[model samples]
Target: MSQAPTTMKASILAPGQIAPNILSSIVVFLVALPLCMGIAIASGVPPAAGLITGVIGGIVVGAFAGSPLLVSGPAAGLAVLVFELVRDHGLVALGPVVLLAGAMQLAAGLFKVGLWFRMVAPAVIHGMLAGIGILIVASQLHVMVDAKPLAGGLQNFGALPGRIWDVVTSKQGLEAGLLGLGVIAVMIGWEKFKPAKLKLVPGALLAIILATAIAQVAQLDVARVDLPANLFGSIEFVGSSGLAMLLDPTLLGIALAFAFIASAETLLSAAAVDSMHTGPRTKYDRELCAQGIGNMLCGAAGALPMTGVIVRSAANVQAGATSRLSTILHGTWLLGFVVLLPWLLRMAPIAALAGILVFTGFKMVNPKQLKELAHFGKGTLAVFLATALMIVATDLLMGVAAGIALSLLLMALRAAYLHVSLKKDEANKTAVLRLTGSATFLNVPRLSEVLDSVPDGTTVTVDMDKLRMIDHACLVLLQDWNRTAHARGCKLVVDWQALEALSEAGSKRGRVQGLTTT
Candidate 1:
């Protein structure tokens, strides 16, 4: 009878969720607009394509989202992937890759494989974010100073000095640089001193609005956002020929890569956002399926691929969103802005949007987070730094692989060092071996050496009370040793209750294979 109330509570919307959702949606709308356009520009695509993805992510995914407040859109995290795809495959081939990626995500959801994505090390995920942050900051800084971004991350970084010099000495880029600086200053000031009463208004939007107003008043000679006369009239769908590219192996591989990376990022964001609120937790499979549908729409519309963006999702939660309605309404607001007010958007300076991205990228590489990882110990810090450096030097997939390999190697080394103490009680003719810490396959040599030394006709006691975990291989070794001892006419009193408990739990789930206490 009491279970009925619990089930009803899960479905019922609390009375307090309505107003907050509406207000939060409006705030998210303002923040997401500039970000969508700026990320699209950074990815070498038309700004309208970013908005197309955003509209599909919000309206389509929001309606079916597992997490109520997790916003999906044209994420900066996916910008690198998009840029690479379009660069290598051409703009025409991007649609087919994205379409195949969507199909992969749909298959992942259908198989309920969302939990497997969580197995990725936290260090790897953080490193990926930090790397992406550095990339974003490096490229956008050039755009902020009214210069074209260089081809690669290192090239962009190397050219910053010249760009700054040009902005300082020449009259060409000075006004845009000033406007970009002004927007950044406003964002910082808004965070520190904005009144509590107007907190619902996002700092990014406020900064953009104030900067645009200043530029208009002073008649600053800076490039503003350029959009089609009728923004909706500018939308173009992918060519039918994209379907033919799906048969090509290289294009198929790109599609799979896009799907895998996007899924991991979205799952990470969903998990993070779930911790920020007390609402219903996310259903990962449902969220993956929803994202699949959203990306499929993006492909069909010839837009950018989408993901669950941490920036917008965090903003949604901080703005007091309580339901999926906030995400849905935010998409509605984006649609209305494109359809009703193209002139107002064109008032925004391009440098101002770059400033917003610069600030966001800075936030992603937080010093406090690095400090926390360092505090855990040298091993953790090493993994974190290695992942971060490799990502900056190489790429996302390679960095993650390196981090996971390092983590496993460290674990094996630590396991190999586990000590198995042996004590001989001469008076009772008894031998006791105490096992401590993890018992992995790496420790088998030392364990075997110690166990085999016991004399025949002796009473050997194996104490495993302090053992943390024993792998199947090690457990099998133990069982074999027990049989050998029995055949040698020695009484082997093995205390393996810990291993028994673990095996028992596994047995209940039909997962305890190759482990036995005979």
Candidate 2:
């Protein structure tokens, strides 16, 4: 008998494997620290919230997560939601709401809702992420150049003309000019530099460090990060008192929204990690549990809520992280820096963080992916564009909801237009039906109407030979029809190959199978 495949462990304790993970973890730490602070600042939360999430995600979730190379932490995907929550409710009120959201996420995992994330159309997901990228760049640009009254999401576009006029007329424009130059340099380095030419260092990291040094030397009047009053601070459980605000129905609604959105984003990120792993596939349920644990720790410790971050996970994969050990090490490095090098962190420039995020935003919006979505269908492209536009205009969750509704509506319209016809033979004892075009939930009622009109005790033949698609909903309908025909003592003949072909085509057409009665 062939031996069972050995499971690969994601820890340095695995014999003879410690050095590469240690080094890779260090690189991830360098990349994550600045990002943690910047994301918190952009989300209108204290920097410590981001740091707390990063530390817990790496040390707690990373230790138990099924994907060995994936990193978990606070992400830009949640920034818009967090910002809205903080704006509507006080900052202190956010802690308990986040805690409840974490609990809901854990419950979702237990109920296997993570699998539902895969049901979302790929175009919709891509569009939502792209919109978030646009938002990140817009929000951070103000901080990069010391501009006040930072415009967010689509609001920035409206304010752009006025902002540009002000920059042209004021001395404040000088810092903006320097920040813009730094962004250009970072982008160039990322696009042109070969991995071998800078094997030991990440281009974004190098660019940020260089930009910070330049800004410090010039003593430019640029905005800089203001470290928390309590550097190297420990999060206290007293933060949980913020939960009392949830007694308000509006606050509860906001918390539920946060829970749903965070669950979707995290599960999607976990799926991406599964795609990247060369080893065993990730167990999504287990990953969800890990995320829940991490989020709870984050909230309890006064940290921003977190999810599995695709950007950070991709960075970990690129940095030669082979196991979960690297994730653990990354967290360790964060703690070390916070406790031992607070002064050094103070020296890091805000411009450097902006450059890194700008690069990240670019990566999130891939032109090639858009081209691929174009090949699927016009409706898919429309949904993608609509989602992106809505996100830029409103917020991420609303944009996604709009895209999903559009996709489903298009699917329903396509189903309603599908054609199916029935004919009777001279023998009078037999009947034949031809199905054409797609059949889905929207077509089930019409199909049933036709079946009910057929004479009793007649031989029924379902000729799906010309049918382009038949979804699970249709399949179940057909199966039920077969049962009723049999109960009436009628012969039912189904073309298995035609049915298989329809199913295959339906899958390609993006129809999801519900319950299979066959």
Q: Would you estimate the TM-scores of all the predictions?
A: 0.82, 0.79
lDDT (Cα, 0-100) at 192 in candidate 1: 92
Give the number of the best model, judged by lDDT: 1
Q: Residue-pair clashes per candidate, as listed?
A: 0, 0
TM-score of 2: 0.79
lDDT of 1: 0.80
Q: Give per-residue CA lDDT, model 2, range 1-518, as digits (tens).
A: 12233334554365556777788898888778877987887778877778878888899888888666778888887776787777767677667777777777778778877777568887887887788878877766655555543445767656767776666687565574466567657757665775785665666666667766877898766666666545545465634246666688877777677776666777777667666655667777777777777776676665788888876776676666678898998998887777776666566666566656666676677667777888998889999999988988877668988999999998878765668798987377898988888777888889989888788788888887667777788888887778777778776789755685577554554444444422
Q: Mind giving the per-residue lDDT tens digits that candidate 1 earns over 1-518? A: 01111111223558876787788898999889988888887787878888878888889999988776889999887787687677777888877788778878988898999778777777767777777778888888988877888766778889898888877777668888888888889889998999999876778888888889988999988888887767667666666677898888978877887898788889999988876766688899988889888888888777889999877988887777767888999999998888788888889898898898888788877767778888877787788778767766776567667888998987778765667998988777898989888777888898899888887777888787777667776888888888878788777786566575544354454443444432
Candidate 2: misplaced stretches above 4 Å?
Answer: 1-13, 149-152, 195-197, 229-240, 417-435, 438-464, 467-518
Q: What lDDT does candidate 1 reach at residue 147?
A: 82
Worst 10 residues of 1 by lDDT: 1-10
Q: Against the hidden true structure, what lDDT does model 2 obtain? A: 0.74
